[model samples]
Target: MTMLEERPLDEPFAADPATARRQAATSPETADRPRSISSRTFDDRMSLGGSAVASLCLVWLLYTVVLPMSGKLGFVLLWFVAFVLLYAGVTAVSQPGPVVRDRIASAVIQGGAAVVLLVLVFTVAYTFVRGFPAYRHLNFFTQDMSSAGPSDPLTQGGIKHAVVGSLIELGIAVLIALPLGLTTAVFMTEIGGRFGRIVRTIVESMTALPDLVAGLFIYAFLLIALGQERNGFAAAVALSITMLPIIARSADVVLRIVPGGLREASLALGASHWRTVWSVVLPTARPGLATALILGMARGIGETAPVLIVSQPSAYFESNPFHNPMNSLPLFAYTGIRAPDTNSHTRGFGAACVLLATVIVLFVVIRILARQRRARDARPRPWTRLARRASS
Candidate 1:
């Protein structure tokens, strides 16, 4: 055939006149209609500006004229709802129905997130503002509450005892809960059986166990039954009860997500099951495990009821957890806030700020540790580097 009459090898023939006509009719240029309102188009920007102005005007009218005349409280909630509705309606005038719906949904989700973030920021700001008086004093971190009376100045006393006690108790709780929780998690993930299932169920159930109930259990067993005095040890035990379930549940989830191929590969290399878990599985999931432990510590650190029930709130500094009663940040804050004095109120807010700072510091430290571990893992070992150098 001549070149002009030959069909190209890659292109298909339409085979019929009707098919060719249909293909021409459905070309890219005419296949789908262009969007009336697109984010990429300048018209979208104009529509957005129009919607904003209309929403503001509608909200102002409702708040000032309609609500006031109806004897209704013209709160910000009414304004917000009016703004959302008016904005959606105004935008829908130029956009397709589906695009307007999606935009409205996106606005609601983003607005909700912004409101939550603002609430958290304002709460922290308010606490710091109220606590500034006590926090500004050098004595607040150095002296104990023993010498400070109801009318004493903010500079006279500090939360030294509470701070020390809280740290010690939290340390003890971590020491006790970490091993048990991690072991339980390992068993749940690696040694699946009826017993493991039972243990998992119990741990899951304990997640919702009340803080007050845990405190009462410890208080009755130690103080009432054994006739022991209120001390930091008993408080630590109570906190451990609170931390155990959280750590176990979190760690179990972390361990379960570890790739099964790593375990199989380790076993293929002639490692025992326990050795494979220790040398391979655990190392692979270290960051997640650390995160679990941090979460558990956060829950334990903020507990007030357990410490309140088991340990007497002491104003004097006590170093030994075994001997005398010890105070903690939560207990101190609770007591101070209930007092009738302004200094006590300031101290209460200050204690709360310290508690928040402690949690933030712990989270930062743990994140740093996890990042360091990941970086170390990413680097080659000394022996591996030496071998590579020799080969080169």
Candidate 2:
């Protein structure tokens, strides 16, 4: 065959015969042609909305009049079920399978998102409102529960000891877990030998390890076998164990997502593997690493079982982890809720609010730090600034 004969013809966009035919068929100018099945017209939107409203009203009527259900929870549940069925059935009548499927997916995703947002808002508001009496007290942050009984008024008792203890234990766990997790992650991503595969498997397995089991592991080995006392150190150890797998797993995933080209570029420029990872890969994935750390912190900090099993609860404020018992927000909340008094319940809710606040603060701090670093990196360099000025 001659090369000139086989040469391709130059054409405008969408100039293929098949594409041209499709465009003509779907064009608004083509009056006799049917509209695209996936296209959502105004009529389609109206039909979908009407279907949803009709389903909701039908569910309400059934729940209130036809059914024995009187609770808000049941009403909402029935509405969701009815809405899904009615919406799908109604859409299928006027639309093709793809359109029906798309509408159903949109409805489910939007409905689920709305429910989750509402639930989260309600939970936060309820916790803050319920804990108002105790949290609003002037001495709440300063006083300890040592001298106060469960029946004592909110004004007389506080979560000072629990707050301090939680911080100390969390600090210890971070110190122990962060480096180890990062090391494990680096090993997995940078050096994936057979041993690395084994390590990855173990980390994944630990991620599903129950909180109670982690507590028991530390309790048996650290508290019993070693003849150690129930203290904050033991609790920190359990928290570390829980946090380690989370941090390592999340970090490994994040590091793996770092662009291989960046690593290659760094190495091609004569950087060692360690230097490339430390300077290029780690810095590139900073935000994700921070997120991984946050997940680990959240998992460990809020654990009640491990702390409860491995560490004794203390009413008095203690600073030394090596000494007597310590108390954390989760443990304090659990114990207080179990006490047979309204005062104790208030304390529990108050501690929960504090725990929530602490987590929020940590999240904000990490986000701010990550953004700040990114902002600095994005700032114009000296030569870039000069070039911009010269251009302007």
Candidate 3:
């Protein structure tokens, strides 16, 4: 047989299964046509379609199909939606099989989402920037809010009393919530048993309790205990009730993320558990703890219902927390909203902008400090060495 006439060895052991299959699949007339392209496309489309159907079913099952059996339906729906989206994303990435078109499509989708998000952010920023300066003058924070009628623009009072009251009440609220929440978190994370379960249940229940319910509970209970009328202190206490559980749960989660190995190491060194927790775990989780507190405060700071029930809004500054119905930023916004003048509404918007900015700035500052602290901790122990040398 001639070398060209005889089948090549490569043909017998061809690496391309499709090529081999094509040769086997076709008669002499049909050998020119391809087979794999349509088959692969069909497989890809089938996989993607199956994924899409499954994803849709998952989304629907949680959101539309299922009845709310537990109070946690929102959380379950959240997870279900996340899972569906993730599955869809995986399917999209895998089915396309590294094609340049898929990459381009992904980029375009991402860019569109980014553009939309940027537009929303810029719109918010523009409104705040424009409205903020309307009341950003020095007098805005300095003058008394007393008897400033809507018609009198020049005599319109500053937010001095409200600002001071807010700061004082917030300070008191933080002092109350921080320790209680931190201790609760420590207990939840460090202790185990049926007690842990109970604590967790209590925290979770507290988390789900309505803010107005909390306000009413505190207003009834604490007001009776203290034998006092509604005042700034009562408002602070009400705010603390809503804030504490959140801080505890969040801090507990953060503390749980601390490596058990760290605690074990400290224990192995003959350190007391309490000491180890205080010196090691607390420090490690400090950033997250700070973030949690800041978040809790942010949640409570804008609260109107609780304050309205527990504290009366006053125009003049009052240093006595127990006797005086103090002016608060939220109360100021409320009055401005209900007032008849456009100027008052503008002022309210300005205050709202300030309040929003304050919360955002605190969150950002918390994150920045956390990062800086982590970096500082990560730095070489040169300072320790220097301290040791000095001691020697």
Candidate 4:
């Protein structure tokens, strides 16, 4: 019988990086070009266009002459239904049963996605437009609302307090939740037992827990039972409760995607489970972990009820989360928008814009870091370079 070759300890996760790099000069992401390879035929295009036009005509006729429906939303709904039926009918005449079904499905999917995208774009655009005046003032980023009244100009008061409070609260929440969630994820993924399964079941259950209930839980436990003051710390704790399950669930999924081969290799090399996870699994799943962090942060950062319930709103800035009252963007926006004044409305819109921008920026920054990590992994290691030079 032929002898079997064993993998070296140093190269457990993958084969020699030097060999792979030398075999291919460019990374897959760098080498590949994106080009659509859709297989739509002329008849397919004709059927789609004809159906859309016919649907619009039919819907318009129904609204104007047949139906009593006067709402734009109802018209759109009817139009979509008409289009699906028309498209399927038209395709069924010339194409196979499968093709007709596929065409109809594609139209519905595209239509649904278009509606969502349109709604998203409109919302962002509307908020920006409404908040343009407030965003234009230099004081909007520098000043707080301590001295400004409701009738004050956009230039007089700003969301500075809300911004600072949100940062402090979210920062605290991240610190508390990240490690706990990471540990929980590791327990569920690497050291899975009956306890781990129970933890997973609880996490999955909490994943759908509503924002209001999270606030109420914290409110009842900390503010009422423990007699804790309404402050940024309480808000942060509430936010952590909201964030914990999200982070744990997301990290669990991410860690689970780490290859079984890598885990087995690590074990075979005499590494303990903890060491294997720390050195191999965690590092390998870094990007996904970053995504989990983002998801957690995104969920908590914009929470309104938690902040509303457990924290006292303040117009002036508060630096300490453990100290007196604080305000966040969502809370600030909600209060401002509900007030009966144009200035408050402008401030509310501006806060909304800022909140949106914050989330987008955070997402972009983390995604960039994730991309950098992937790119670094794709690059040949230092020892790989040394080995290549010696081999050459």
TM-score of 2: 0.85
Q: Give residue 67's error in model 2 in angstroms.
A: 4.1
lDDT for each residue of candidate 2 in 72-107, tens digit (9 for 90 to 100): 897888888888888898777655567678888988
Order the numbered candidates by TM-score, best leading: 4, 2, 1, 3
- Candidate 4 local Cα displacement, residue 193, angstroms: 1.4
Work out the TM-score per prediction: 0.84, 0.85, 0.68, 0.86
Q: Residue 252 of model 2: what lDDT?
A: 98
The 10-residue segment with the lowest total lDDT in model 2: 383-392
Query: All models: lDDT?
Result: 0.86, 0.88, 0.75, 0.87
Query: Which candidate comes out best when scored by lDDT?
Result: 2
Higher lDDT: candidate 1 or 3?
Answer: 1
For lDDT, candidate 1 versus 2, the one ahead is 2
Q: Record all residue pairs in model 3 with backbone atoms less than 3 Å apart, i.e. clashing.
A: none
lDDT of 4 by residue, 236-310 (tens): 999999999999999999999889998787677666777778877898899999999999999999999999999
Provide the global lDDT of candidate 4 against the true structure: 0.87
Task: Please list the residue runs of candidate 3 whose C-alpha ends up more than 4 Å from where it truly belongs after superposition.
Answer: 1-123, 126-130, 379-392
Q: After superposition, how far is residue 315 of candidate 2 from its true place, in Å?
A: 1.0
Please write out the lDDT profile of model 1 over residues 21-90, one tens digit for every residue: 4555455765795543335456556665666677667777776777654433344466557657876876
Best by TM-score: 4
lDDT of 1: 0.86
In model 2, pairs of residues that clash are none
Better of 1 and 4 by lDDT: 4
